[model samples]
Target chain A: MEVQLQSWQNMKLAQVPHMLAGHAMPWVLAARRSAFERFAAHCFPTRREEEWKYTDVSIIGRRSSLAPDHIPPDPSSEAKLLAWTLASESLYLMVFVNGHYAPGLSMTDDLPAGVRMASLANILENGADLPESYFDPQHEHTIFAALNNAFATDGMVLDLSPGTVLKAPIYLLYIASGHGVAIYPRNIVVAGEDAQATVIEHYMGTLDAHNFTNAVTQISLSAHAEIEHCKLLQEGPAATHVAGIHAEQASDSHFISHSFALGGRLARNDITAQLLGKSCHCTMNGLYLLNERQHLDHHTRIDHLAPECISREYYRGILDGESHGVFNGKVVVHPGANKTDAHQANHNLLLSRQAEVDTKPQLEIFADDVKCTHGATVGQLDDDSLFYLRSRGIDAELARSVLIYGFTNDIIGRVNMPELRTRIEHLVLERLPQGDQIKELL
Target chain B: MLTIKNLHVSIDDNGNGKEILRGINLNVKAGEVHAIMGPNASGKSTLAQVLAGREGYQVTAGSVRYLGQDLLAMTPEQRACEGIFLAFQYPVEIPGVSNALFLKTALNAMRKQHGLPELDAMDFLSLVRERMKRVGMDEALLSRAVNEGFSGGEKKRNEILQLTVLEPRLAILDETDSGLDIDALKLVADGVNDMRSPERSIVLVTHYQRLLDYIVPDVVHVLSQGCIVKSGDANLARELERHGYSRVETENTAKQVA
Candidate 1:
């Protein structure tokens, strides 16, 4: 705990509120002056706070010593960080080095007509006038989100033309580099009316690199628009990754988000979707596999503001070694959101005796006629199933691993993208404690 | 070959030291099909369960010898590896496990324990395709989850299909014919008949003689009050079918037949 606090404090120089005022966000920093003042009036939540009770981020608070007055020139860590980005052949790649866009590695030539994809810095310098309206005006300094807003030096800015459908996925890689370095990478995606597209954000780092990633991404879907957004975070084991995703859905729009987290010593992912229009739909799915003293937490909130909107969420986790996992989900049905159909479930498989899980699935319904259900379960492999397998001559250890993987496979098999699914399967199997024991079985 | 002598069994879960098998005795040689007929609560299934080494059934006093080994001493899996198989009365539906995959795993496990080379996936598929035909089971059934979404008859045929694949030395069919139509009964009987060999034996547990009419066991024994009260050839099954258990008990009790 002390180690984590020290790490947090060391990151104070790169803190969101201070860094925002110091960097490219001067206009936003000035526009949200009162909000920033309100942010400063309240400190980050501690363990005593009920929302943060199960997870302790004080270790992040302790990393004040690592903070630097200014970003280092020619950061020695950029090379290793760039090499870890997913370089799949089919993806239209956009790379960010130390939170700065590196156009040298980007290949965005064949983007569909009327699509706008550019670095935030380019948009700001080329008289694009994104203005303060693009920034989340409703967001107060949320500590981490404010920190990301303050220090976001380079981010992907995407705007789709009305009724345009992109055939290929847009890949954005946010790489955090340098020892004791901290980065806040922000992304803004806006889809015009009747547009459809898929965007994937990759948060990655090199092996053993000590850094912090505080990122915020917002996606806006207009009337009749559809979007599929995915986030894959596989940072270095010594790194701390905190992210917030906010989505606003318009009339008859649809949004699907999948988040996969497989790295970092401490990681927390927060997602909030506001269904503001009638007949809008939102689906959220996540998979997290943690081992070897890792801590992973997922907090999701879905708000149905209009009638006839539907939201569904499913999340699964595999915890091994002494790792800890936390899942907190809430589905909110507003007064006018009658006939809202919302379902949320969180299931965890603890592979080791010391592994632990804290799960809370909630439904806050104001509309009486809505159908809302939520459930959370944490358990180990069924011993009867294990014995049944062992009776078929599978060794005890192999039998247990098979059942555990099979339990989590229910979610993995749902991932329709073959390559991503295969890669994730390998990653999950690699992190399992006795994964080798089940090789023959697989 | 399978042999049981003076077997005594008891269940102690409910704090009642009640005996389920009261000094029962039975013998079965290779190539023999012996049917144990009894009413409900007559300890018929208990005898089959004891032979399969199911947990929680205490063998208070008895000796069971299979292929000259201490059958009572072997674990369920060990008993399975040594060619002992039990076709459960109510097959458990494993939601995500495929039937063919399950049978392949069971077959390969037995083969591995016997020091035989395991079959490849293609070989296993071919083997399963052949055995399923003998049981008159639909080939499509293999692609489904094990017994999940299966009808009662499909589950019964699946058990017989397993019997045909494992080819255990002693097959204990625990009421395998309980919930079956006439067509399904013939298929199950055909499956059992195909597995009969000079080196294999079988113990069929049932409460009715309808199954016997199709399978035609070599011997039939009336099990009443936890003990065998009568033993005879195939004609005995026909007699019970004609006169019913009460009449058989009367005719046999009057003679004090063993």
Candidate 2:
């Protein structure tokens, strides 16, 4: 297993020196060096680890020398890139191709006043914040997070000032098109006091473009601030996706995350949030649809570190064919965090006999006066529910599609953005039978 | 409107057939109301399920004809579009599917089958609002997920609401009187009475004669095991209420021996 995972260690540091030399900032070099040491020390996780027991990433570890290359963007690659893009003209769009900023394809010129938004590489190369404050790396980092920090070439950074409110969401599209390409995107969002922003990140690739994408994002929300982060991972059919998101919310702040994993042969996402102040509200909603030989796992945790905080988590999955899906949710109400109200539920619908799901809910309540409830259910379409709908005049196929659509729409409905929700609905529809006809039913 | 001959029904348990209905025979004319009374596990619900084309039950030997067509050969939706409606004993709850959307879709699907144009949102809302008044149901329930979090009486009222909205020619009400109080029962009965016309027929499946008091049935049949042992006018339900099923069973067995 060590040898198989040594694919990253076996890769020459040649590409790193070249990428680092472009950004002569000493802190940039220092951060990269420390991250590399951490990455080397921890190595890749295996099935033996409790947090990753259900997700086996040996397939990713076996990749031969996973590193990004500056492949010249061709006309067809650009076309393919645009096909997977989810940004509208009304929103600010940033496109990163092959782990480097594609300035010609980006739409960041319309940023409002007091907004400090740029790519990480550009921030390091030109002039930027202090090294210690630029990247707020958590003390306890996973191997994948360390790897992303050490090797990422470019990523979106939205450093909003106090009282700044983004009228529209900022969209970031990251594409890994070239074969054998591995894109490590390290995104950071620091929302100051009373600031509000919505950040939409989409990781995508063509159907046959084999690649690996390891993304790490850290978000810090100040008092009274609100941040909604939505991510859609729709990579190629043979791609591997491993992502980690950590958020810290202050007093009276609101942080919401919506994660949709619909593609890739192997994918795993770990999202955690800490309610660090009184009256803080945090929500984590996710939906994953997998079929064929694809496998997806979602691990989510919410810690109520302050009194009288509220946290809610809801995740649903639709598994078909021979695919495998896993949902593990944990909500912890720390000691003295009294009056903490936490709720978590995970439900899955299996469409085929060969499809499988592993679901579990872990709730820890150390506080004496707290309300925490968690439930996990894995099942096929309810036979009675199906028959009830069918006993009406609805056709058999349309009834089936409507039930599936309703199952996923439960999560998508919480998105609040109609445009993003509609697009996500379309992506989910493509996986259903006669899904096009469901538009009429809706 | 309906004809049943030698209706022998059974459910498949593993590989063997567990019989529920044995060699039953009956006929129902248009514009008539018939009440079927029996004890628990007497195959009353199975009969309604089979009529509605529900799965998990097999007609080992039987023939059911509806409007001169073989009712057993139709799918549930096909039967529904063809004017067959069954009010389930335990109404199913469908989360995430609002009652308004479900009712609109169902009504439109039936209308499309009949070559009629579909109703828009406003028109459908008006129609449902009017029907909700007749069924004594809350208008707020239309926006809620179907049957979810509904009380037992509310679920029964919802079933009656669907019967009124769909306006099927033949309605089979299976145990619609079980979960309702007297007030709700009268309201539900009035909803059914409103739909009663010269072209429609109603089949009431109940254990007590109480529901028949509100909506009187022209005739009543007593099913003892898998067969209708004896039948008479509405008085038969009154007699069964006083004597219970054991007396009727004894008399039925004596008659069989004779």
Candidate 3:
């Protein structure tokens, strides 16, 4: 396996020099080189590893060449894609087309004081704080993260200074246009003490694009800062997406993450948060809707490294038409992290006999005095509920659809932003089997 | 308006078929209220379930006709749209579907089947409000999920509210008064009484005669061991209340043996 991975790395090495040639900074070059070494050292995970037991990424590793460097931009396609994003006037939009920043489509006119936002490539070229300060190549040993760092062309970077509170959210939209392309996007977000902000990352692609998106996002929250982060993946049906989010929370800081995965042939999300300060809190909520041979996996881990911290996680999935879903949530309470409170739950509903789901929630506690609980449930729509609807004159198919929508809405209802929640509700309903029929009822 | 002939019903429990109803026969005309009184496992509830087209119950030999059409041929939803309503003994709790949305969906389905226009939101709200008043139901229940976390009496009232809103041609109440207090029983009975009309027929299946004191039945039948042992006027219910079902079962058995 290691030999195969090394050979795979060698095949893609030809593109690195071209990528490196564009950057002159020594730290940037060294970071890329170190990331490449790490990628070459590790093999793509197999089912034998417990973390990868239910997912296989060999198809991703088998690709010999890097994605094509250029794809002509289409304005009509960009407009159509932008129509799905939030239309609020206060939003700051940054667009990325084919892994490169599209300055023509971005808008950042009314940003508040002490808030700085720009593309990573632009920031790095300008000699600002090195990207190494935000992301440590040595800390991320996963093959996909390493590959993303080594080959990423551009990404978004947002920073809020001390005591700064943004009145609007930052929207980062990533769009892929061509087939058989590999696009890596790296994002860095830092919040200073007592600051507050929200960030939304949306990924989309063309229907004909069979591309792979390897993305990584790192967030650092200082004391008393609060941040709400949301990621929406509505890629093309043939696309493959692998995303990772690593967050660090300081004392009394709060971080919440909402992940909605609706499209992709094979989509996987790995989220890890470290509560490194006392009295900090973190919340992770996710919803995945899959149909027609699509597969989605969500793996989350939260470590309570200090005392009096809280972590809560709730995830739900609706699978239909031979699709599959996997959810694995792990929480660890380190020694001396007393008074920690953690709760995690995952519920899934299968709409077809062929649809499947596997969910596992784990808790590891080294602290003696802590409160932690985890649970997972996978089931079909309730027979009694279906019959009740039918007996009230609803058709069988519409009844099933309504029940499914209701099941997913339980999680969507938790989203505090009404406009965004409504948009997500529409997206979820439009993807259901009998979406047309259920749309009328809602 | 309704007819049943030689109805035999069985259920498949883990591939083992068990007969629950044996050769049951009955008839009813329009504008008539009939009461079926029986002890446990007497097939009273099974008869109601069969009429409503619930799955997993096989009719080995039976014919149920309603309004000159074959009732057994339609699906449950089809039967519901065609004006056959069954108030379930144990109302199902749907956790996320609001009661108001459920009723509108149901009412619209029935209207579409009957070639009537669907109600708009305002019209639906007014219609449900009127029916809710008749059933003595709180208006807040309309916003909550269907029977989710509802008290026993509230669930029963919700069923009555649905019956009122649907306004079916044939109504069957299966043990609707089993878990209600006296006041709730009277409220439920009054709701049923309000729907009584020349074009509608009702069959009340219950174990107690107390409910009969509020909504008097036109006819009474004593069901024992999956068959009706006796059929009489409303006075027969009073007699059953005075003497236990054991006396009636013994008399019927003696007559059969003799």
TM-scores for chain A over all candidates: 0.87, 0.94, 0.94
Point to the candidate with the largest DockQ: 3
Candidate chain B TM-scores, in order: 0.95, 0.99, 0.98
Clashes of each: 21, 0, 0
lDDT of 2 by residue, A278-326 (tens): 9999999999999999999998889899999999999999998999998
Better model by TM-score: candidate 1 vs candidate 3: 3
* Fnat for every candidate: 0.17, 0.63, 0.62
**Stretches of candidate 2 exceeding 4 Å from the true structure:** A1-11, A20-22, A71-89, A103-112, A130-140, A332-339, A364-370, B12-17, B111-123, B238-247
| Clash pairs for candidate 3 | none
Candidate 2 residue pairs in backbone clash: none
Docking class of 2: medium
- What local lDDT score does residue B250 receive in model 2, on the 0 to 100 scale? 95
Give the worst 10-residue stretch by lDDT in candidate 3 chain B.
B93-102
Candidate 1, residue A242: Cα displacement in angstroms equals 2.5
Minimal lDDT window, size 10, model 2 chain B? B93-102
The CAPRI quality class of candidate 3 comes to medium
lDDT of each: 0.77, 0.86, 0.86
Shift in Å, residue B229, candidate 2: 2.1
Model 2 chain A poorest ten-residue lDDT run: A13-22
Q: Which is superior by DockQ, 1 or 3? A: 3
